[model samples]
Target: MEIIPKLDDRLKDSLYIQLYRYFKHEIEQFTFETGMRLPSIRYLADRLNVSNTTVQMAYQQLLAEGYIESRARSGYFIAELDSDFIESTVTPCTKLSSEDSSEQKEKHILYDFFMSDIDTDHFPLASWRKYANKLLNSEHKDVLKYGEYQGELGLRKALSDYLHRSRGVHCTPEQVVIASGTQSILHILYQLIRWKNKRLAMEDPGYQGVRRSLQGQDIKLVPIPVEKDGLSIREFKKVQADAVYITPSHQYPLGMVMPIAKRIQLLAWANEQESWIIEDDYDGEFRYRGKPIPSLQGIDEHSRVIYIGTFSKSLMPAIRVSYMVLPPALLETYKHLEWGQTASRLHQQTLTLFIENGEWEQHIRKMRTLYKKKQAVLLETIKSVMGEHVHVSGQNAGLHIVLHVKSNCPADTLIACAEKAGIKVYGTSSYLNQNKTSCSLPILLGFGGLSLNDIKQGIKLLHKAWLPYYKSSEQCSVTP
Candidate 1:
């Protein structure tokens, strides 16, 4: 059996990627049917006129990613298609997204609601105007030249002070490196940990974007379940991962805080396993009730934690400014890796002045009040609409709340019906980790950027869409 290879001039992907795709495309098209064996690396290499290394890399990547698993000395064969599990449990999100799907299509539409952001209107635009103008007129003369690899010095220094004081993050300016956002931080993180041959323990029913960012990478992810108290410490220990990515302040989707006990236990587990703890602290800035819980990094006696903080959630998601508060040993190694200024000199300077001039503090205080009011309205709205037909999870804090449906309604069906009715809702399946319950039913609805009126109307629309499946007394009883 021989296969001839052809090259496309327009295929900008790596040669190995092209080879990988060539085989995958054929397999997906069923040109290579079930029980078919894939060509050998050396044979494919000779036919394609590419190096053996390229063919080997392509096959190795596929094997590692579970696209094709190799049997001992039996050569490679098409993986058994677990159609039921694969179709229901896996993401509809392909690396290269399909335009035909409702999610992708709705994203392109004007009223789509996959938005993960806070109200920018609450920002002190006047202060930013002053700083922005100052940068344009004066700061640019010096900063206009190419800047530091981590970020502009002024911004880093300001952020260093702000994070330490405001968020209980433990880091010096030297330990901090600014990047575009969380994904940028994850990329650097992926590079650091990939060489260690360690599995990454990710929070189940967590952030889809983070999951997607690390998908198909060399690192294997052990998706640990998050319980009421926080991540199940027992499950965490079982994973024995190189690093654990957590949103302890308010666990994403669930809104559950990692209690102090669990926090201490998590750090101890990290120490025992010789692993790292990545504290995302994603949306810690705006807690509606109770005293501020200290960051997991602040209490760390051992330097096992890598603290990540972002300005996106508090101010605006477009801020695109996040920093990694590194451990001392890794700090020096990261210093030399800094290349082109990922953060603009002007953008940095403007952010710096905002933090320095007491603008950010005031802005956050106002936003906290505004978002608290919004949260109250959302609770009331959902209660009025869904009533006994639903239960709200993770509502103590954060900009979003997960509303769990109590009826026999499939989460996917509810989402589809909502979309058809011009309402947007994200199902629990979107955030499930491996080993997660496939039957979990919840919709994560964000409220920080929306007004009370919008919340009321949105809930009304959602209730209308939900009425079909949840109409019977068996599904829901009218609240007195």
Candidate 2:
């Protein structure tokens, strides 16, 4: 059958892609019947006044997508697709407006307080570019090759030294398994321990990213309550979990550091139970009050802790470099399993150079100072503008703070109001696995990415948006 696709040169889409879409739509509509022969690439190219490569590329795409099949001598023919398959692949034209509207709404947002955002303006771009370019030279073309299974050796060695000096983490280069991000590292750890560790206990209001990752692995998750000092050691002692995940350096959302006594107690419990502990020290470098607490792995003599660290907060999130220090037993298991590296080799080399040149520590020092100032401004503005109506916590460490708003409105309602007024705030309810109803309304506002002026103005705007629901102490008594 002759196939003629109307090609447009003025449109943004290339001629091949447009032609591919046209043939795809026609095949889905059954305009091209099952087993019907498509026009030859040369004939179609000549008829459509396009190059043979364009027609060949379009046919190749269709063939790859199962819409067409190519025979050795029969050229291309429409595949026999079922009705259900065709219906599922069809896209309705009505979705365009909703997608466009969503994009427009995002454009209107003046301030976004995303918890994962880092201060991109302060990133050491020049230094990073210098290192990246150095690696891109002809002499360093070996970066294009596959990296070590555990990760690049030099990067792991650098990470080990940096972790020891900065966080007091005890490990050698061999124990470090670098991956693309925290979730990927967690997935690898789960594979190594899944046979023995069937039940995992996590904090009640913990990092949901880890929770979701574990949930997918078919392991039962037990939510232990988080106390003022961190995860409740008393409650943790009662559970028969094979492993426990904790953010002890600075508790997530609540912003409370785990005391040294509790850390030792928790370590003793793990030692006694012969269980494992996964310590995620995310954003451990930034501490505004008192001296920084040593990492849990530093104090553990039992070798039961799996220490996870990331450069996303310290340097820049775009680098996508995160590593985990595995205990000797897990490292043995990982060696037997033989997994390929997931992180980019080029990035790994660049990071290695950045650390070796003493730039990584230097950058962290700069960022910590800058973030301290931003957090101070954020806290001051919240107090001055919201006054007695808002109670803030999770300060002095990390990029974000949690606000317990004293109002009749729920956390979701407050977030919606903030968005409508061109500000973005996050809700904390999703982080809790249980006991959500007993807690007060908590909103998370990150000040890392926002400017000092934007921080003050955003809080003022948020207060104005929430003014209608704000009540005096006597009128509302919501406990945080």
Best by TM-score: 2
After superposition, which runs of candidate 1 have C-alpha atoms over 4 Å from their true positions? 1-115, 435-439, 475-480
In candidate 2, where is summed lDDT lowest over 10 consecutive residues? 91-100
Summarize candidate 1's per-residue lDDT along 339-370 as a digit string, tens digits.
45565666777888888888888888888889
Name the lDDT value of residue 72 in candidate 1.
Answer: 85
Q: What is every candidate's alpha-carbon RMSD to the true fold?
A: 17.7, 17.2
Instruction: For residue 336, give model 1's deviation from the true position in Å.
Output: 3.4
Give lDDT for model 1: 0.73
Per-model lDDT: 0.73, 0.83
At residue 171, what lDDT does model 1 achieve? 77
